[model samples]
Target: MTERSKEQEQGGQVRELLATRADEVSLPDGWADRVLRDGKRAVGRRRLAATTAAVAAVAAVGVLLSGLPGTGEQPPASRPEWATADSVPQALRKMPVGPDTDVPYGTRGEQGKGALRVMLGGRAIPIPKEYTGLRIWRAGDRGFVYLADGPGDVSVVVHVDADGTSTELERTAKGEHTTQLNVSEDGRFAAWTVHPYEGRSQVVKRADLTTGKVGSRSYDDIDSVHGFAGDDVLINWDARVQNIGSLDRDGTPWPSADRDGGVEDYSVASDTVLLSTSDGCMRAYSIAQPDNQRWKVCDMEDVHFSPDGQRFVALREGGYVVSDTSSGEVTGGLWSVPSVHPQDMAWEDDDTVLLELAEAKPARTKDGMIAPIAPQYGPSYLVRCHVEQERCELVDTGGPVKAFPSSSS
Candidate 1:
């Protein structure tokens, strides 16, 4: 009779979701206006800076006083009533302080430089040459290069002795697949989900900068870990066998075995698994469990947490659902994406979800004949129906390619 029991009895719906076209969705009001305002402010700054020389001749300290058109008039970033920065777990706030590189988190590479860069507070410091998909990880007296080579292989290289130069320390074997990559908060260690071809399918590994030694922490019988908390790594392998466990910097195992659960797919924030799934549906899980596990299922359809784990959003019939997980409630949809995370979703902001929809596009490649063409990303929706708002809106990103979450590999 109850939803939980109903889920237990039938194993819930194992149905695959359907995708749709993009043009059907509508953009919310003020969305474009807001972006336009930001653009104008940026343009105004260039004009002001150029005129500084002339302004000095005409007036006294006047250039600094110009304040631009909407400088003071712009509204503060709208923080949703339910989304509080403090409400987020402490681990997220624990990301460390270190030297930065000019690489963007998910970018492959650009302008002869690697796409990856070291970032903090949204500011990115270039990681030297921006190559495509190169993630820059900072370690004490070293800089490590990580590539989000999908759910398959990953590349790791180290740069030593800050002449702003580098060297390739090691390149893992081809058969090994990397799932999770955690950069230590202290910038002294790195943890990765290493699936070596010869031995166990996957294991947690830690690399120490000082000794140049990489070794396994104890193995949790799971597919891979979601992420790390501080220097502690969290492992989750199977829907039924998966458990959340911790590994210290020295590769020491935390006392608790792991939080047992049926997790089909999930995502992690600094210390918590903000999104989790079982055979039935994807729900938000809490990291505060006594044994370190607790997940509450919502009525949301195809639900997931944001890449930053600051918000909860989902897709349902003709609408989407965005909710606050800390509280057992629905924030409803910000707007309909005409889809939600259809194939994969990317967060454009706190208010919108970028849906990568699936559609049958005729392809010329030979692989298309055997496999259903991997769906392409459609558009970025500036939704409001997200989180139970009065109405929902949408924005078109005009995409038709594979995409992933910003902070997620």
Candidate 2:
């Protein structure tokens, strides 16, 4: 059957999946490398600045030169191939722009300062202070629901109406460093990890957004909550094992979603699961029938599925590719410079996506030459790409925006 016909056959299930897919977003890739490189650079700068006063001026200049692009300190970022103004590809022409209406998008405080902001009704609505980590999804016509991390490991689950009214719900503590908040696409359920002191296993807490009632299930080895597939919660079983499994709403273990290997992603909307293995390949499977494989790709990593489950973006060696989910057809691909990589992607609308290009820290090679870029570094840029038009433009969201994609919160 044609992919279109197969999609149509799914009917309401597909629609429901797409609706929830809006809330699904990929986390920043290479986060560890970025943090490590950033830390090293920061220390080097600090030590240089603290040098003897006689050489302070020279050291300051040296620091400045070290950070400048193409100065042997770091490689210059090259423009994405598909975004080049001089060479437009036919495959990207006449691309659909998806929906025109505004959706609630997520943003962090500049430099992770201030409160997390949500752009809604043409204005930025700031969430509560000390923004730890946050996830947002539309609350039907009422406005948006935010699952935010507050000061002191507090989990803030609140709903904001269209008129700017905020109604906060009560939930258990979200334990320290618990930043990821996964919500169902319909905004009906939210899941997070709760680590109590002296506990044997962390508890995965599921909160009902509508009734404000909370349910808890304890697992001996849950590394984190992946997300919700329908009302079932997906979890990363153990850090070492890297197993993916599911749990019922009441927190009972459900092996139906069980799979080995790290999770590339789990589409809560479509109940589709993507897993990556050691051989450097990824495969998509139905969450319901775990054995039912949908598609698989080799030598690809960092997969992010679109909200409609029609397409996905994945990173290859030189750059990234956008592909059909069912058939694994390569729809479009872009060549990227070695200095930068497409670290993250989020669906801005139906046809447009936001890509974050991250710079890597330059290292010294043999013969006293500087090494090329690696996929590590913070403070990345946001580029919005139109899938059909095959065109991408750098997105400037007023001030400095975080490297993460702005989800429909």
Candidate 3:
């Protein structure tokens, strides 16, 4: 067993928190994004036509966000002035704080995550006392994080890189209104979960901030949809747990997983989907083979397939353990905390992770700042985490413990 100290990527915490699980995941573009959420606006920032809880896959927002044509055809949604694409600290932009109207939810605990802010272009974007959609920019010697009532509402994105170097990108939606926003790493794309109806849907859409070209996806298959496998494949039950249908990279429903059983959590690395069975078993499959070599099984809890699938990490009863996919070897058994069956897990970067300690709550809080006031299973969870090496950090972004916050913070 390896020392239970190293944190795995598949076990990281999200950037922000949402009110519902639907706000947590999103699909790819075109067919993939469409089938996932069923054409519904996302729960993050941007233009939303209606604010409805129609989380029925991409067929949610404004009707069906998916099933539409992925011709990149339509003119981009009309972005508002306040919704400019100027740069802001990518970190703060991903926080759970929003609108500045509602109060935070979930278990109240002492925050541990240091103020993780974003550096737009080059400068740090300051979070507004009220998050009313802002733009972030980094000029020569100055950095600005500005918010507007709407786009075009501001002429420039604060300041150009002083001497004409402007890495400012404004984000705006033309079709509906948005509640959440997400900017890609290269800064070439921006996806938003819009709002219009007073409803919630398991839907989401992404757009090239500059082109305004949009795409969508979803995960409303609660009973059917199992989890995400790798980059583009979404694992869903066929007959048995491992008898999974594999959605291609393009999100077009493809083949199926070779193995079968009560698939718990499935992770995709390379060409295989590492699946964990309910009976404490595990196996790997090749998207191409779907049913060839069904190998490996281990007794573990909270099994997570690594990003590359070369291996998997499971938080077993007493400690953590890592397994080699090829030979099903217990490379190492990490540390142990307590008996906690994590509800959700994400890889922060690769090594470290952000845990919610969710199971702990409905259980306990650090300083006990929060006492079950109206304890009724009404979001009374404390988001604290032990990031592998150090102490337990608090996830107090005011976002959904499950949601990665609004991709657009």
Candidate 4:
């Protein structure tokens, strides 16, 4: 069967799973209340600035599961609060314009003239000279996470504001490599994971961008860090278990879910942990209740939750699909592009996504198996898609583009 057919088969199986459970899974009594109470307690303990509003919003929505049969009535359609043209947050509004070029990620020699630029407000904004040669991760429009190599083989994670000021959030000594850095949806904290070459333990660290206070916890045999769920960090340890725990305290084991198929990747929201399993299924587990899981089977390989966690973008059959995390309903139609890497996509806002389109030609083996493209492939462009409107526009980033985390609250 063709790849599209396989995706359809998987989608059909998922529908069947949901259909079988429709009558059996009713909204648990006081679920909303419990979620709110628990969420508030967690937020208060962590003093998280970013997730406070989100927890409240989820409470107001009541039903967490989308498209479930038990919801009494469908709510009237209303524009998302961040959908307006003016809704682009202030941090992302004004960027310093610069010369445009097609080679954004090229080497110094390959960049003929002018500095590299990033696409902001559809204009190419020159990257500050101080940020040149550093790996830049946009942390919302509010600021950036710059991974720069320092003296003595140390690496620093610097937080740079949109206006060009910066502060060092954290630093790593030699032998430790920072594998992932994720800014919380609210932009108050930056959480990252570090792997040590000499040790088996993986360290998860969080820097309070507001206070400059940093905290961390270490786990044995950690596979990856899946960002933050409110104040706590989500970690996949030993390749088979996922845990959510505080970064400041070391104590009793936090709540965990064991996956037999192994976890491929995961995204955490305040109320739920969405896992993309090795078996090719997406599972949502309630943070308040770990044993409860809702599964959706599909051909989605990589899963990325929007800043608010209300929606997610997944790769299906060489294209992109945006869906409601709760209901698994596609909000936008399929977007077909030449090549999209999960790491190369970021949510511009709740309703928009920024994608990096690679120009490399896909390689087909003798048996017709497509080989993965390396990052070095030449020429890429930045494309911004409005998920709700189902339209995309090309933006000029002097070179390749890397999206930072959203800073909007």
Candidate 5:
């Protein structure tokens, strides 16, 4: 099968790790200035990359942020500063490291009843009972943007900070089906697709987590929502024609990558876009200077850029490879069970990856072909793989894995 079709087939099994899926939308005015302000407010540099997580076909809600909206074209006065946008290197260098925290994790069922049963740093974070079946994405060091199913047809969007203070950012409007929440790498903005029951058009809504302002644009046809680039939202529209564009915050649209190319993933740190060529090749391009190509790969499939934008992980040659983003050279490898099928892959941190895989044991059949001993395994597992060490440790073994270590099993 073709690479694109293979990735799509795998995408079904890889639901939990589909956070790297791309969609695009709009950002507000003074995006660069806002990014600069956030950078200045940063205290110390942290290497961890904040990324959004998404589940297949699930909808989330948009909500209120803490700050006041900016007046005129100037940056908002009340928005919290998080990172820089002056330069890619400086942005990565200046990213603030907040309180000690690990990526939130829990077994599959924990998202159902007893929501917020997720463990951070080995402690159970208490979540409100109303916020059931929570799907969380890392925001700031001590913060997260989450979507939870509320009473009735309601789904609420919320932000939780380092102090464990929960802020309701948004809740779904009546008769609205909100797509999964996608957060910027710096945790300053959240974007999602909204299908209102009253209309046939799709609306992409973006919430400024700092200014508490939400921006939206309507389109007759939207294929998918990519994540973010700096503050610009990436989107793919006109599926049949494959039109792609980077949407600005103030309703202005930025130059997009090749129209015929499909966006594979994005890196906010470098403002880079990884795209798939119409003919099935992959390349990385700069969103600011569309002509400035960073790297290209003709054979890679299911590419995921690291949180820092310096590296990426992809399934290549039937194995997982970590390659440098600048040169597209394989730098390291990840452990995987050939007998097991991976459903999804999420970056636990800059140097680590979390993979959801079908738990299976390899067996040799009469034909000497290696296959799973059984037709099915009980439940999938989240395996933590270290990039540099080339090793993997099981995180979900049908129970909590001890405080969910920050760097170790």
Candidate 6:
């Protein structure tokens, strides 16, 4: 049998076994209802111990038998002790100032209220007032990139240094909306897409920090900037072709493997571009050879690769799963969170991810059943999950705020 076929057959068999095992595990009738009742009561009484116990029980059962034969590889044998919400201290954990320890992050502040702030070591460092409405791209211990409303209603790219010095780069006409800013891993080149209001034409812009040179290219139907592979900017044009080339050139185009469904989102790494298809599959393509295709995972949505490009996290049915990039082996048990936004999730390190936890409200259904209500963008808290160790801790940020890891961290 071909290698791909063999892999498919093995995956099918393992999934079947998991399904059967789930069915064979017996529990008391109305277990979900009982758990909900007790959980609600525990929360009302402010008994954190009970809640932690309940969470631990659920996490214990989340480990699937992924060590079956034909699976690529197994996870590390030593796992850290699982942490509970109560066990995690209710204080901002101070990240040491060092080569690979500090994590710089940006928070959403009231627009036109004051200067923007980036949180580091539990302290808020203020940026210049001109760069007020800032959306951070690449943050590091040294410098960062962001987009803000410049003078004359134009959108300007601002680069800030750790010493509080800032420089405003190229300015584009403020369009109907602005896409996220993407910077190379080295914090040198930055790219983003601008959609003009009148013409409806899309432009991909890139700036080189070393030379202070900015260039752009206009495309009829360019979607957004994925990221920077090396010096080249990866573009998703027309929602059909994912091109990898220079910002000054036409570039090479690779047709989406799932052309019928289209590409939902994509992330560029050192050697490959990970594309999440709308039909719920993660596909990887070589940057050097666009035509080379490899299927990574199936039935997984909202896929994102870790910053280091060694692992990836994807949303499964009930929760999220982390897998090795090369082997595609499930390295950690399922991680459950309340109404997680996959796009908001990012890697703090190889073994940990910073996730936004949505707030849930109880709602009564027509049948007199109580259900939890959650909104896409609601009051959210940041939590750090240790994937391999199956532990999570709430990051005390004082209140609900959006946070992302600095590229250097």
TM-score of each: 0.46, 0.59, 0.37, 0.62, 0.59, 0.64
Residue 117 local lDDT, model 3: 35
Model 4 lowest lDDT segment of ten: 89-98
lDDT of 4 by residue, 1-409 (tens): 9766765565445434433433354534443333333222221112333233343434324442454322212221212232222423221122111222222222222232455444333334455544434565555555556565566666678776555556887778778766566776666777777778676657777777766788887666777665666666666676544445566554334344466577777777667677777787877777677667765655775666776779888777666777777777766543553433333566665676765555444676789777675433434444555564333434433334443332211
Model 6 lDDT tens row, 302-370: 556777788877666655678777666666643444344433566766677766555334566799777
**What would the per-residue lDDT of candidate 1 be over residues 7-112, giving only the tens digit for each residue?**
4333212110000111112223332233222211221112322133222212211211353321111121332322223422221112111111222223223321
Candidates 1 and 5 compared: the better one by TM-score is: 5
lDDT of each: 0.39, 0.52, 0.35, 0.53, 0.52, 0.55
Give the worst 10-residue stretch by lDDT in candidate 1. Answer: 14-23
Per model, how many backbone clashes are there? 37, 9, 115, 12, 23, 0
Query: After best superposition, candidate 4 residue 296: deviation in angstroms?
Result: 2.1
TM-score winner between candidates 5 and 6: 6
The CA lDDT at 175 in model 3 is: 35
Model 3: weakest 10-residue lDDT segment is: 10-19
Where model 3 places Cα greater than 4 Å from the true spot, the runs are: 1-212, 217-259, 262-264, 278-280, 305-308, 339-409
Clashes of 1: 37
Taking all chains together, the TM-score of candidate 4 against the true structure is 0.62
Model 5 lDDT vs. the true structure?
0.52
Q: Model 6 segments beyond 4 Å from truth?
A: 1-101, 108-116, 121-123, 127-134, 140-142, 149-153, 174-177, 250-260, 339-343, 362-378, 396-399, 403-409
RMSD of each: 17.1, 18.6, 22.2, 16.9, 20.1, 13.1
TM-score, cand. 1 vs. native: 0.46
For model 2, residues 168-215, the per-residue Cα lDDT tens digits are 754445443344456665557666676554443477666676666677
> In model 4, which runs have C-alpha deviations exceeding 4 angstroms?
1-135, 150-152, 240-244, 250-255, 339-343, 362-376, 398-409
Score candidate 6 by lDDT. Answer: 0.55
Model 3 per-residue lDDT tens digits across residues 1-409: 3322222211121111111222433322333322222222221222222222222322222222233321111212322222222221222222221121111112112232333233333233333223334433111123221222344322212222223233433334443344333233223444333333344424444433344345565534222333332323243433333222222124534344334456566555456656666667766666666666567767665655443455556665544555676766666543333432233343333333333232232434588666665222222122222222221222324332212211111
